[model samples]
Every structure is written in C-alpha cells, then in structure tokens.
Target: MITMSPASSNINSTDLDYYCTETPTVAIIWCVLGVLCACVGIPASVWLLWVLVQRQRSGTSNDIYVVNLTVMDLFYNVGTAPSMINYIAFRNHAFVLLDEILYSFSAIGRPLFMTCMCMDCFMAVVYPITYMKMKRYRYRLLSCAAVWGITPCIGTINAFIWYSPIPGALYWLLVPTIAICDLAILYTLRKPDPSGRSDVHPQKQRALQTITNSFVMTLVCYLPLMAMGPFLRLMPASDQVKFCVISLLVYIAPLLGGIIMPLLQLHSLGRLRGLLYCTRDSGSSEQPDQQL
Candidate 1:
C-alpha cells in the first residue's frame, strides 16, 4: 500500500529510484509468499533427491543437471528463508544484501541448468551418434561443475553492481538458444527418418514432450522479470503501486521454478504415485528422474 507523495510526484522519471514505500500489509504478503516457497521447495527438493539417489545406477546426463537444479532450488529456498522474518520486521540493509546475493545464485542457476537440459536433449535427438559418444556420467559431472563455477562469478557481478543487467542479459541469451533447440527437436522429430521408419522411439517422443513442457515452464516463470525492465521504464515515476506489483513478481520469480520443477519432473516421469508411497510395478513408474 503505497500512496503518492509530493516529493515523489515531483521527481523526474530519469532520476527516480526503483524503491517503492510499502505498508505492513504488503510486507506481510511478501512474508507469506516466502513462507510458501520455503514450505513447498524444501520437501520437494529433498524428495526428488531421494528418488534420484534410488535410481542413480541407471541415471542419464539429464539427471546430473536435475540434481544440480534441485540443489540450487534448495539453496534458494533455505538461503532466503531469513528474509521472510526480515520482511515483517524490517532488518538491517546488510541482511537484505546477503539475501540478494543468494537470489543471484538462484537466478543464474535455474536457467543455466535448464539450458543444459535443453542442450542435452538437443544433442541426443539431433546427433545420436555423437551424443552417445560423449554420454558419460563424468562428462555430465564436469559440465555441472563448470556451471557451478560460472554461477558465483556472474552472481557476484549482479550483487555488486546496482541494477545490473547481467542476469537479464543471460536470460535473454538463453531464451533464444533454448527456443532454437526446442524448434530443432520438434523439426527433427517430425521429419521422417531416411531409414523409412514410421514409428518414433517412445523415449524420443517422451523426451520431446518433457522438454517442451519445461520450456513453457521456464517462460512462465521468467518472462515477467525479463519484461519488467522495459515495463518499468515506460511507467511513470509516481506509479508506486504498479511498480510494487512488478517488483514483487520479480522477487517471486526465483521461487516459482523451485515449486513447479519438482512436480513437473514427477508428473512427466509418471511417478506421481510415488508421492503417496504407493508402490507401483509399472516400468514408467520405475524410470529415473529425467525431466527438469
């Protein structure tokens, strides 16, 4: 609940800051959303990790990325949990800075791993022989290690630079790359094989559907924040309410992926019954956690 003040109303749009004065109700709402993110993210990541561990013997490259993705989500949920309390009872700015650093990790990590997942599928479908040639667990592990190494560097840049564009730039770069991979996958799958085969492999069909769904999820979770920069620029300086709403959505963006990813992985793998502890002997139910 922000009311327009005379000082703010008089400010030039170019010099206006991003901060919007908020009321107790707004703070409470943020706290509640943070609580929901932690409550859902923690157990879901833990459960997914447990499931992955159970199937590690036959896990694929995608599972390696999924493992890191889940870890990043857990980091986001746990690392930012303190901010919920700080939201309701305003804390020192230093605490908020630390939270922003943690957020930067998540912001980079989620899309980074998602891009890995898409690229993995891209190689698998588009170049089967080469994909198989390089398809070792160690290679995937190395890739994950590389992404982990990269996260801190970019995250640090975002943390120290006020209103840094690196995160958004990274997302913009990834979005088109992911789209091309998705389109390539779709095109490759739709074209008939030169071998005169009428049937697509069941696993390929499943993989296509899973990746498409993930791409959609990524867009849903991230597009708003990516678009926020332009929208904010067009908005008037004194429009605090819309600014606050967009700002909240940007803050909540990291959490959306954490909550949705686990459920998406479960559903795509036909393992929803695993949530109930109801054992199933079906082959699909026994499949490894491959979707991200």
Candidate 2:
C-alpha cells in the first residue's frame, strides 16, 4: 500500500478537517455544479461523437478539426463527469483505482486535447493552401489517431514522474507549453490570408473563430488551476482555503472545457446548424448535402 509520511499525513488530515468544518453552503454549491455538469456534458458529448462520426463518413473537411475537438471533449466529459459526481458524493473518502485512472486521464486529456486543437488551428491557418490541396478527411483521421494515441503515453509518463516529488515544476512546464502553443495559434490567426482578401467565406471564418474561442475558453478555465499550484505547495498547511479551492478549480476546469467548449463550437460553426435544420432555406441549402 502507498504510505504517507508524517508531514503528508498531517496535510491530508488538515485538509479533511477543513472540509468537514467549512461552510456547508460551499459544499452544496459544488454538488449542484457537479450534477449539472454531468447532466449536460454526458448527452452533449455523445451527440457530438455521433455527429462527428457521421460527418467523417460523409467527408466534410469544413469542421473536421472541430469534430476531433468534440471527440476529445466527449472523452473528457465521459471520463470526468461521473468521477466528479462521486467525489462530491463521497466527500474525500479513498477513491478506487478506476476512479483514479479516470480522473488522471481526464486531467491530462483535457490539456492534451486543447494542445491538439491549437495545433490543428496552426495547420489550418499557416498552411491554408496545403490544407486545401490535401485529402483532408484522410489527414484528419490520421491526426485524430495521433492525438489519441500520443496523449495517454505522455500523460502516463508525466504522472509517474511528477505527481509525487516535483508537482510544481511539472505544472510550470505544462502551463508554459499550453500557453506557448496557444500563442502560436493566435499568431497564425493574425497573419494575412494568402488570397490577399479582407473577407473569407462565412463558414471558414466561423470555423476559425470556433477554434479561437475554444482556445480562449481553455486558457481561462485552466489559469486558476495552474496559478493555484504554487500556492498549494507553498502553503501546504492551510486547511480551509487551499484544498477547497484546488478541488473546486480542478473540477471546474474540465467541466467548462468538456461542456462549454463544444457548445461554443456548435454556436459558431454553421455546419452543425445546417445539418440540424436541413429544411431551412439558408445558405446551407446550396451545398451538395452529404449524409449527416
């Protein structure tokens, strides 16, 4: 069995005591949020997967990256939501290994997906001509495979290496990596369109805007968690505030990423709108309607 040292044990004790003695109102709020997240995230993620798979089959590249992003969000929601509910239900009891695994996967997967989406945006903006020339469906399939395959390995390694001895450094590294990649994506968006035109297709522009919004949403959700790490390590003994804050932020970040990001995309991307409302005589009616 994994054992805690005196200091670590004391820290855990203090944390539990804090939670037990703290305002019940805060706990109720967290529980309500947790339930709401699970209720909304679970079905939305499933729908996103169904929609993406159908679109993939029909070979629409217009929002393939968005589809991949939706899949990642699906994984996050499916993996994380129940665990959050359980944590709120159980209130700091020892979680099973399966819960640990799911929680770890969700934590790591959220950031990894954001990184992959940023990379996808970079590819779309920096290599527009190349992206247009290629067989986008095939490339998207390969890219999805790479993101799903590679992220678990990276997460596993990082978890083993950093969770115990060097939490701060690991978080520092992760934050910077996320920040840099996001900045690169932002820069890519700012560059002049190769066609030398001020205006682009509404669909294309919306797709890009969806990516931008997703990135911003991710950064906003995660910043608090990242900022909390140093404070957590430095003031490890603080009982009422630190643990509650950390737990709340950790849960909220993935909740927002999984639930909010896709909704943002659905609002921004007209393809989904078109697919959902095929009877409407919008600009979407002109295209050769692909299956789903």
Candidate 3:
C-alpha cells in the first residue's frame, strides 16, 4: 500500500493542476491593462524623476514626497511584469507570491506617500509658521526611510494574509484622511492672502486645485477595490468567479494609480506643461530657427 505524507494528505492535485493551467478572464484583462499602463507610466515616471533630481535645491526639500511617489510608481508598474508573464502563460504558482509581495509594496506605499504630500500642503497653507519651523530635509528623509523600512514588513504580512480585508481596510482609511486635508486646504486657500498680494492667491489656488485632482485620482483608483474587499469574505476560496472579478479590481486599483500618479504629481508641481506641451513649443521655436 502507498502512503501519503502528512502535508500532502489533504492536498488536491486536480485542483492545483487546474489552477495552474487555466487562465481566468479577469487575469487576461489585467495583463492587457497592466501592459498599456506600464508603457505610459514607466517613461513618465522616469522623466519626472529626472526633472526632480535636476531641479533639486535646498528650499525645495518638500519634493522628497513626490520623489518617493515617483519611485513607488516605478515599482508598481514594473512589478506587474512577473504576474503578467505567469498569468498569460498559464504557468504554475511559483511567482504568484513574489508578484503579490511586489504589489503590496506599492499598495501600501501609495497612500502613505500621498498622505505625506497632503499633510505637507496642508501645513504650508493652513499653518505656514509651523510648517516653516518643521520643514527640514533630514527630517523628511528620515520619515521616508521609516516608511521604506515599514513597507516590507507590512507588505510581507499582506502577501501572507492577502485574503484578509484588514490590510485593504487600513489603506482605504487613508482616503478619507487625505480628502479631509484637501478640503481644509481648499477652505484656507479661499481666504484673502494676509500678505496683501492679490496676485499670489491665484497661483496658490491653482496649486491647490492640482493637489485636489490628485486626491480625486486616488479615489478613482481605490474605491472599487475598497468596496470589493468585504465581498471577498462572503465568497468561497474555491470560487473562480469571485477570484476573477476581485482579482481584476484588486490589481487594477494600483495599476491605475501607477499610471495617473506621475501626471498628477507634475501638475501639482506646475510642470505638467513641461511634460506634455513643452516639446511642442521647443519644436515651434526650432522650426522658426530652421526657416531662418
């Protein structure tokens, strides 16, 4: 008589083989969307990082948050590669854990970094005195370092307990916090400048608008995934239908976030036109020169 090992006694080889061989529709859609987003987001993020590094100065130390956001975008977009390959090829689960861990990095990092940006803007607008006193590159760098160190631990937890709604709920909570900061900044920006410069308020208002738009982008990407998390618990672990729908949405949130984040960051920094429209202006100028 043949005997099975204790660990293998409960394992179902048929289910495992089916899972490895079958590609879900949601996963297919996810791979396609991920590829498209990576194409645009990767280049935009790299360019934005280049611009940020080139323009770095002592007074602009607050840009560390945006720089970190850009890096998160890079991780988010590029990290999809392994999952895409595995899913498209209908391969085994060898890379699934690694892919999920990579995703958790951005999933956790995005909100934390965005909260930092919101708070940075909030303090600058709402309490300039305190902001000025607290503003220091070393402090911000340390804060980012803490976040970097914390991310892997949290991400590892997330990877292990991916089915748990707790992680998703925690990140979802940041949306309201960021929205509150955006609202507070909006209220403050509306008041007349105490400095008595009417011209300055418009620029400030424009900046605030860009920041608000970024918050909106977060909502767009995050809400569906947040809403879907609870439903996951109601479904069975063996439910392929549930997996398809939830997995599509679960990954799409961060994919969309990775895609749109750099554009929003550039807009907030008043560099949107530099990325989108500056080349046209440069071309026009060169055309005139070539005619001469």
TM-score of each: 0.79, 0.68, 0.79
TM-score, prediction 1 = 0.79
Backbone clashes counted, model 3: 0
In candidate 3 the C-alpha lDDT for residue 190 amounts to 74
Which stretches of model 3 miss by more than 4 angstroms? 1-23, 57-62, 90-92, 194-206, 234-238, 268-292
Query: Which predicted model would earn the best lDDT?
Result: 1
Question: Candidate 1: worst 10 consecutive residues by lDDT?
Answer: 1-10
Q: How accurate is candidate 3 locally (lDDT)?
A: 0.66
Candidate 3: give the clashing pairs: none
Model 2: per-residue Cα lDDT over 77-126, one tens digit each? 56555555554455443432344434434455556556656665666766
lDDT of 1 by residue, 1-292 (tens): 1111112121233443334445345545665777787888888878777776667766542477887887887788786567667644665456655666567556777788888888988888899899999856787788799888888777656545555667668878877787778888888888887999999888877887768776776677777666775566666655554444545656566566767887777666667766555654454565765442
Better of 2 and 3 by lDDT: 3
Model 1 sits at a Cα RMSD from the real structure of 8.0
Q: Considering only N, C-alpha and C atoms within 3 Å, which residue pairs clash in candidate 2? A: none
